[model samples]
Target chain A: MAKVGLFLGCITPLRYPGIESSTIDVLEALGVEAKILQGTSCCPAPGVFRSFDQEVWRALGARNLALAEEQGVEILNICNGCFGSLSESSHQLREDPKKLEKVNNILSQIGKKYNGTAKVRHFAEFLYRDVGLENIAKRVKNKQDHLKVAVHYGCHFLKPRMLKEIDDPERPKILDELVEVTGAKSIPYKDKQMCCGAGGGVRARTKDVAQKMTIQKMENINEVGANVIVDVCPFCHLQFDQGQEEVETKVPVLHLSQLYVLAFGLPKERMGVEAHAIPVNF
Target chain B: MSEEGEPKLVNPEFTKEVIKRGADTITLCFQCATCTGGCPSGRITAFRTRKLMRRVQLGFKEDVLPSDELWLCTTCMTCDERCPRGVKITDIIMTLRNMAVEEGHMAEAHKRTAGMLIKTGHAIPMGDKFRELRKTLKLDEVPPTVLCDPKLYEDVVKIMKATEFDKLIGERIDG
Candidate 1:
């Protein structure tokens, strides 16, 4: 059993409640003894500062991390964006001498510091590393059968080439491995490493561009002949799921969290499947 | 010729501002088309991600703004992650979107979606059917994370306060 700060990203909170709820369910089902940490905020993703104001992005991100540190718990992120930003910022705080000084200065004002403390774990990583796939398989009351899923790692969870976390940057298998625990087959695609085009406010920015990116992602999914795309981030799920029409393809999207919930025999309704852009048959 | 000439852009000022604010990652874009290829939203419409970045590089705000292309993006952050040049493509797109909404020029669907998101905290708009289904399944109602945790509300409130996101949507009743 491990203590955790459930770092639900912006999308999971407002868009994909199912993922958040299911993550809690899966973790609890695993008997890991998890608890949601209080006082969480936007990861202040590189989406904000690295593009507009690195200073604010860092300051704000440090603020989020500080809360996790203050609580004395490891950070478990559900969103790829938060995973990327938090991991990178944590890297900066630990390795980058200059960034640490600058971010620390801002922290002084907030009376907080990143402090090189606490490990940031994506929910999938948490299951693989902390709980182990075999351990999770033991708890699966219902394992999905004949379900084919295409895993979308998204970009933030795998890239920037420096976070150095998870498996392969282009072909990560943590999601696939976890899907196996639920008795689901994870498929591959041409654009498996492609971005969902939901970052940078693309969904809110303009539908045209959003659709363009969606189409490409869908093309990849279409080629794989998978019924669903299993993912971790809610934003990615939104971009691929709700944005699937925008993807110009009609494959359903499922968060790895939802799969876990279903594997525990949670009904589709309990997992928020109907709310998805493409309704899940099961 | 590509390196020697000015890249196409929608808003040079917006691009300049983005770059000046440490978004020089936009400057590293060499038009390798990785972002365009990797972009999930770029496959729709005529608005190519590469072209959008080009427009940003050239700082053509007039061209970039007021286009359905800008709002089309879902901001999944793929381009930024794959850019060998490390271009902050998502950042550029977000700034442009924020600017669009600030000016009250966003698409009606976008506004309605935002409204729905604000009101229900859920992207898809569904009525009592799902709620009743929740009851039938005996599913734990969507645990109001906000209601369950006031502290999160406070933190978000502060971040929004500092970012002035609310001010940007003045007099706009979010559905």
Candidate 2:
């Protein structure tokens, strides 16, 4: 139960504030103080900035981490992409003195210095590892056994298993186990570990290609008759939530935090189903 | 050189540059195609991660950098994880992309995204509509990001300037 600076990446705050509200609610219920990291920017986006300019990406990510450092807490990211950028940058900055010097050089212009001590945590991993499943299970006042969730661990949260080491990249069970804690069934589907096709700047550059990938995953989810898609990244959440409109699928999407909010039996309005393209059926 | 004496497309310097940019694992790729086999984007698009790695290893800078297929990788790291030779496939792709941007081959959409990040400190900048939604959610009008404080945003601008990212994308946008 360490304090966490809730790192709200762009999509969660700008596009899906419900995830923000619900995440805060769920964390408070679980007895974790979720501090808002003011003056934070984008995890600067991994695929876009990292692809375009690694130097810029590291500098911007360092600034965000520095913000959390000033608050004296671990940076808790709910989005897989944000986790990927911040954690990767933080890891590199910590391990490589030369790279740390380079990023600090950039930070110096902003009146900041990165000590490379900033720790980044994905919220799901924090809950699974720190909070423990039994504790989460105990807080579920409203069981969502009706929700057959197609759990998406999203790429960065698990893959590059060399770095993340969360679960078996090919056969992840973290999300499934977490989902089942709320009395929901995590339905196994084909290509369970597939990417949402929106990462690496592909969604922004090539919409049709991104949609094709989403449709493929949706087909697998639909075949399994999963009632909803549960994702850990706001980017993936956006892909499934909005991509459903193009593919004409009714399976709603929810961030893991939002799903927990529902399981906690908090007010439905806080989940912000109204902002969703595909309605949350349950 | 097939007797026609066509211009050589390879540039060893380009290969050296990619390695210098932190994807030295590019040399480890023996063209096993393991990177392509599991690539979700390659299944539907012309993006072949294995081929791209091959081109990089061969120093075919022209073939490697400017191709639209370079941007098609979703960087899922499936290929990176599955590589038996320990090639950091996604990292190589990212390195190639950075090199591509340096050569002025960025896609318009990605350039626009970079523009947004430069302007608002977020790749996806805030819209006026989200302000009302935040108020309805009983949250702050702005979510305490760089957008809330001009001085903090000025700090972001300084970082971008120091990195010359403002010059990289800004010059192209105005040009």
Candidate 3:
């Protein structure tokens, strides 16, 4: 129930509005005041700079951080990619004064300066921490008793631990806990820790690589007989949901927001269910 | 192995944002070749992410952009996750791909695909053949939201403008 800025990266807002609609529903139901960050861009992601120039990565990411800082609020990210890139980059700037100064110098040209002033949080962390799982379950007027869900922890949020304050890095429990709030069963599955093929912008630049990884994740989820896979990151959600068709997988994928909307008994249209590639019958 | 000031010639048009957007991840990589080692295309050939990163960081734009190896990356994100430094291998590749498009350096096959994506939102055209497949599977479908909306490009551009990516790119292109 805290006021925060909602950061939806390049793909989520217009491309996947269902995810946004559902995310908003859950947060508002909990009495949280979420304002969308108007000036945010691509996380500008680490891969771009880590490949092109070391210094520029810090600057672009810091610029993103500075924009959130402009609002003077902790920014909760809907995409795991954005959360991972922003939080990790913020940590880097705060930890290294020299690097921070160089990044700030670049930002000054854009009229922005980041001293790593705000906190970057993923929705999973916000849900379990701020709203509390017990509180979320209390509002579940309609329960999805038949929906068997697989909780996918996106790699960026799951990796290089200590940054993800919500769930344990290895064997994450928070996402599973959120699924339970809908009265859905969160299945235990193998390769549950695997990365989505879409992250790091692979789905955009490289199709074969992205599709192959999607196939691997698809096979893993199928192996467990999960009816649907639930996830936090837009990158991950797109991969398993729509990207599954890049190969020939049938199991549907759901962003956590999408799934939660269903459990909340909202209209399927509002959940943007029609937009999904793998149709969610539930 | 090279000496400094041998005339450090970065392409002037490649702004800090351009470089940052595309290949900034070069520094986060080491020469482990894990990216290449696990690369789906590397199974058939010897494409290596480490080598690609090395070239990009060195500003070997031509080498990085048009390489058949660069086109072969599948973007599994495994390497991005595996990197001990957590460098994003896929986004780096995307940046290089985007630069190739902007510079008209894209290979014949690559340019055609980008054109297809711009027009269809998919890399391949769906003439009658795909419709037949959809009918066969009973997989009735409509254009994805990102594609169905006539104004998707304008909306995306607006978001980019919101983030000032437009301004960043404009500055470099105008100059």
lDDT of each: 0.66, 0.88, 0.64
Per-prediction DockQ, in order?
A: 0.21, 0.87, 0.10
- In order, the TM-score of chain B in each prediction is 0.70, 0.93, 0.60
Across residues A1-282, which tens digit of lDDT does each residue of candidate 2 receive?
778999988999999999999998999899998878788988978888999999989899999988888889999999999999998888888989998999988888778888877788999999999899999999999999888889998899987787887888987788899999999999989998999989999899999999999999999999999988999898999999888766755688999999998899887788866678787867
Off by over 4 Å in 1: A13-15, A44-60, A88-118, A244-250, A266-269, B1-20, B23-175
Model 2 residue A1 CA deviation in Å: 2.1
**DockQ-based CAPRI category assigned to the predicted complex of candidate 2:** high
Highest TM-score model number: 2
Q: For model 2, what is the alpha-carbon lDDT of residue B155?
A: 94
Task: Quickly count the clashes in candidate 1.
Answer: 49
Ranking by DockQ: 2, 1, 3
Q: Candidate 1's residue-wise lDDT over A81-154, tens digit each?
A: 78878886777677767877776765665456777776787787888888898898888887687788888887
lDDT of 1 at A18: 67
Best by DockQ, which number?
2
